[model samples]
Target: MKLTRPLLILLAIVVLAGGYFYFADSSDDSGQSNLLVSVKEGPLLVTIHASGELQAKRSEKIKGPDGLRSVGLYRVTIEDLIPEGTVVKEGDYVASLDKTELDEKIKESQTEIDKIETQLDQIRIDTAIEMRGLRDQLINLKFSLEDKKLSMELSKYEPQAIQKQAQLDMEKSEREYAQLENKLILTREKSIAKVGEIDASYRQQEHKLNRLLGFQKKMTIMAPKDGMVIYIRNWNGKRGPGSQISGWDATVAELPDLSEMMTMAYINEVDISKVMPGQNARITVDAFPGKEFQGLVVTKANIGEQIRNYDTKVFEVIVILQEQDSLLRPAMTTGISITVDSIGTCLQIPLEAIQSDSLSFVFKKTRTGFIKQEVVTGPSTDIDISIALGLSKNDMVSLNAPSHADDLEFVYLDQDEKRQMIQELENALTRRIKAQQVIARSVKQENLQSKDTGGSTFIIF
Candidate 1:
């Protein structure tokens, strides 16, 4: 048994056969799958998907100015979210503050006014009493002067000495009368001036107090124009506007006109250069579907703001809607796609179809498998990439291909081997069919005008 060459040869043959079968099966399982596609001539649109918000084209926020007095002691509670899309008219009561505190303020001011009035009345009375005393003194002095004059006349007939004494007495009486008259006149003028000063002071104080009181009375918030109410959310872990009296950081509410709407979006700095004013855009709101609103780029921010962990700077862009709807509200989140550039009837391919290292190529499906064909590519939009060379109209190509094929050793299949490749071919055929369907559907669905440049059928497996 140890020296049997026949037995050794038989074992050797069995091992060889087993090895061949094992290799064959393994190759079959690891073979590339087929991808099917039909190349059709059509227009491709490149779009940039940007998220933004639906907003009024012209909207103003009516905010309560800081330090506006409250109407009552009861504070305003701004908890309710106004019903969405409710139309309002001018002078409508959007929100109101309690008036109790304002009332108390008014009363206090009134009390102050009353106190000033009382002081003024007392001053006037004192001036009148002084004036009356001056008048009585003047009358007594006049009567004494008249008696002295009469005495002088009678003494003139008696003696020259008596006449002289009478004359001196009359002179003293006349001087007294004149002094009393001057004093009365001066007292009356002083009294009148005092009363005028008091009255002027009271009026000034009253005017100032009244103005303040009037402002307090207007503390009841009212809408300046017809619009819808939108409540702004508070940020930085703080309550929304009108939450506290911590000195005037309140957002109370906003009245936004429904007729005008605009979408505000932030675009990354890398792509901001592609955006400009007057570019057409399509907008979709999360609240609505199958409804696309038309808009135009109205503004592009010159500056950038950091966003996310990448700290990428983004520029703000505003898109104005052509038509406004009642459903449109301020700050509603929206998805906006700005058409930075659109080429009608341009040759394009799916972004996934192109593979690049130092050069780019697309996989052209064949009966056996896929063959790599080099392509000259052009600018890429969000979805499709422009193919400038090495591809013709209606040239069928694979959407996605394996990345490691460049490193694999090339293998050529004979007729028999190719016949055995039915499974792979069928899979490729199925994929090609689906790809064709997709292309056709896309053309019809997108209303794309397509023309066949070449006769090439794509098989996706």
Candidate 2:
């Protein structure tokens, strides 16, 4: 049974050829299987999906009182806050601000006020005593004047020289009495004025102390309305230790009305125009899977804003929930699918069926194999796309490339194709946007130059 050397070499060549042909045929079969897909007529719903967080449309923000608005007391820090997500009633304690500083200020002011009041009382008493002493001196002066006059009259009966001396002495006493009376009146008026000044000072300090006490009372923040509490980011722009809530910047907790809720989503700038108010939407919370809610687009931002930590700009779209759920809470992640357009019947195929670079086309099955057919596409959903022309309900199309087809090739364009379409639209939009920006800048510059020129002319004139 042993074979010769030439026969052995021939046998090896035959085995290698057989293995090559078997693999080649197997690959061709696998490729053919990838090509076969059916094109059918069905309903196509064009939708735009966006992810965002839930929030209340109207929230009652509870912040610390704008503090004292005085030097070193313009802001207050939150010392205690009710647990987040706690349901609170109106007038319930929401937060308490640090009262140490304000309390100390009030104490100092009260002490100063009390000291001033005591000084005022003593001043009033001293003024009264001084007035009484002045009155007594005045009475004494009047009596002495009367006695001198009587003596002068008695001397008039005895001797002319003595009577003349008595009269002169009485005139001197009259002058002294008049001067004493005037002095007593002036002293009384001066004492009254002094007491009034001290009393005014006391009143001013008392009012200041009362104002400080009022600030102390304002340190405790109460819920203005019944709602659930949601803790807010602190002054340091975060919510952990070392972060403190402040009244100066209005950083505090939010009391959001749970009855009305909405999800705030950022739509890509390219898709912003497609989203409109009043469009219906279906929403699902990531935390509560299998639970769905309905909503409508209530608002779309007229201007686009850049998302933090991202370079692309996005428009904020508000979707109001039509039904309220007890499990739904603010800040929960939401998956929103908005129905922008829908059609009753249309010739559609899987999104994978379409192939394009500059032109759009799909591979149509033929009796021989498969052939390329140009297509006109309309609105598309996440999976299937609507063909407006060049397709029929019974037509069979390849979702991928066939083994024998040369023009058709399988291209992985699952999400990439959608992004490409958006990119192309964005490019067109960017060009138009740039043109508008240029014109706007030109107008602004012209206005500014005109103002400057007018000012110069006025100065020259």
Candidate 3:
């Protein structure tokens, strides 16, 4: 078509202005629509959730003798240890300690005992020899006394002076014999006491050696019950760099009975009060998806432990598993949902559906539109809340406020206005459905027309 330059420029401007206005209006209408949700009626459970790991409720700790218990012996080393994760029976060997120290101590004690016994034998021999010599001296003194006595009797018939001298000699012999007899008795008693002392010391050394031998036999540790062996890690304290645990610091491992399992959950002080013993709980092991186990809170800590490298404090809570599973293992991570409270049936809604506190409100949908309705709420959880009043089943509510709500006045709606709005909404929806139908019809008609015309036409704005 032929056209002037000024007219062509005016036409381009008009087309560009029309296109801009159309696109701008479409963009405005394309802004986010209101998100709506429905108030529901169902079972609402208020739960306190925590994360923890599985542990044995009744487990035995494998530990070596520590200070004072070791009886002043040097650190004992593990000569042989059973591998971790081995299932063991009662009285089965778990590990063995080096017995070289005990053997050396026993030998030393035996040597000491031998030395004492040798001294005791020598004392016995010397005492016997000394006692024999003392007896011989006593016998000789008695014989001399008898001879003096006989001499005194014969001198009585000889002369008065000679008889007196013989009597003096007899008296001297009698005194010497008495003195020899007393010395013999004292020597025997001293020898007996000395022998008894040496024998007592020898027995004491033997007893000590026997005790050491017993301990040496005890060097091999045995399992007290049937359970799985779990090697302990960083017990009493952490291992030094590039060094193994000494017997003094060694905690060998644990024998946990897998039959009875419990969860060791740490709850922060904020939520700790809400958890209590005998509370019903549901546990989900991370290792097994979609499987849940039931449990009860069995224990709670009175004191809180400081979190590692953090300022927070957490109290340990034990949840006893009601059912045992073969797949459940100690130290496996688990998700615990403790049902602190539960109600059979109630009106509930998403947590986001309710607004405000003290006097709560929800935007409930009427047949017309949404209205700010006052609501009474009860216990709530992270996702669902129980509506005690001011709501009913099948009630729809807006999850968010309307875009134009700030511009509109929040006036109380009269009965007539509510009815009018409901009618308007219904009419609008009906019109939308009709419009869709008309478009479908138009497309069908166009197809027929194109078939009749055997061609098509394009209209551009």
Candidate 4:
């Protein structure tokens, strides 16, 4: 079994040749998998992606009064939306609470007031009649006194017998006249006192009735400012009842300034420390695509708290938009990207360029073929990753390449398909634009008609 030295050497040579061929073939397959991409110069932006909402910069969320007495039996119903962007004047009826019960109360109070007024008038008439009788009695008393005096004088000039009889007659007449005078004076004083008491009572009742009427007026809810009406629902999610209910703190409606707005965002504790006042942000709403609004971080919460689904503590952040849009409204969901840090004119690449396991690499197009070049990367955002080293501007790299494609046929067909998809998308966009224009025109015509009918109309763009 032991071979000669020359034979052993020959065998080793054959094995080595076979091993080389296998290695070369494997290397070729690996090389074919490499992707080709292109690099370009652009501004690099680093942002933190956070889902937020589009809210008024200074919204007033009105809550109904907390006590049971403040709520009436009648429930308020929303007859209309008040057209989101309509301008309102002061003291306008933003929304109405059902005032049937309150209105009835007012009528009842008014009736009582009227009845009291009539009783007061009757009291005055009675007093006037009593005064007239007193006046007549006083006149008779004065005449009796004068007649007695005259008789006494005549008796003094006549004989003694006639003097005694005249004196008795004068005394009797004097007593009768004094009694009449005292009775008349007492009756007049009593009548005067009764009139004063009745007047005070009537005034007190009038004040009480007036206060009740005023309280009833509170049921007719009126707008505090010139703004749009927004309905408020309870935490339980019920809006309003069909009929008036006695005990619910449901906020029927509110008026808010449509021009001004602010956004509220919750930052988790991990990222809260990086957030600060005056930070720049970009706001995007789900309802509006291809549109971004400029916003500034106006506030950062000093404390953290837990809410609904999030287990970690969250700090509130308020963002103010530079301009107000008609489409923006309270509670409209939005996505906010806070620019934590950004460097201008920095070299960057798509986030997909970086591979997993903290290793970053890009395919560099060289004279021979696309080669895998190792790269050093820094912080990465959702869209782009910062290139720290190993990549220069104007380098051509592959976006996505098939490593297993033996020929260019597959690549050509893929490119054609991509173009067709893009064309379809463009056609769809054109149709959407046309449809939107038709809707816009219809809205415009409706607004004009509303104006002619002396009502308000709102159009959101």
Model 3, total clashes: 0
Better of 2 and 3 by lDDT: 2
TM-score of each: 0.60, 0.65, 0.64, 0.48
Ranking by TM-score: 2, 3, 1, 4
Off by over 4 Å in 4: 1-32, 59-87, 98-213, 233-251, 285-288, 304-314, 326-333, 356-374, 394-461
lDDT of each: 0.63, 0.72, 0.70, 0.60
Model 4 lDDT tens row, 57-166: 33343333234253233344333334444456766654445555556655766776687777778877887887688778768867876887788897798999899988
Model 1 RMSD in angstroms: 16.2
Model 1 TM-score on a 0 to 1 scale: 0.60
1-461 in candidate 2: lDDT tens per residue? 35688798999999888754533232233445644556788887778998988876556667666645652475566777777888989999877778777888878888888888888889878878887887888789789889998998789787888988999999998998888888878987887888788878888877778777777777788998888888664213333223454435544677777787888789988788777666778999999989999988766778898777546898878788999998889889999998876667778898999988576888776554556777767668889988766677877787776665565543333455556655654564466456534442442111110110111111000
Which pairs, if any, clash in model 2? none
- The residue-by-residue lDDT of candidate 3 on 62-148, one tens digit each, is 655444144446566667778777899988988877777778888899899989988988998898888898888888888888999
lDDT of 3 at 144: 88
Q: Which stretches of candidate 1 lie over 4 Å from their true place?
A: 1-42, 58-92, 98-101, 147-173, 205-217, 221-228, 232-260, 301-315, 323-326, 349-376, 390-461
Instruction: Report RMSD (Å) for each prediction in the order shown.
Output: 16.2, 14.1, 21.6, 16.8
lDDT of 1: 0.63
Q: Highest lDDT among the candidates is held by which one?
A: 2
- Those runs of model 2 whose alpha carbons end farther than 4 Å from true positions after fitting are 1-36, 57-73, 87-94, 118-187, 190-194, 214-228, 232-256, 394-461
Q: Can you give the lDDT of residue 114 in candidate 2?
A: 82
Error of 3 at 49 (Å): 2.2
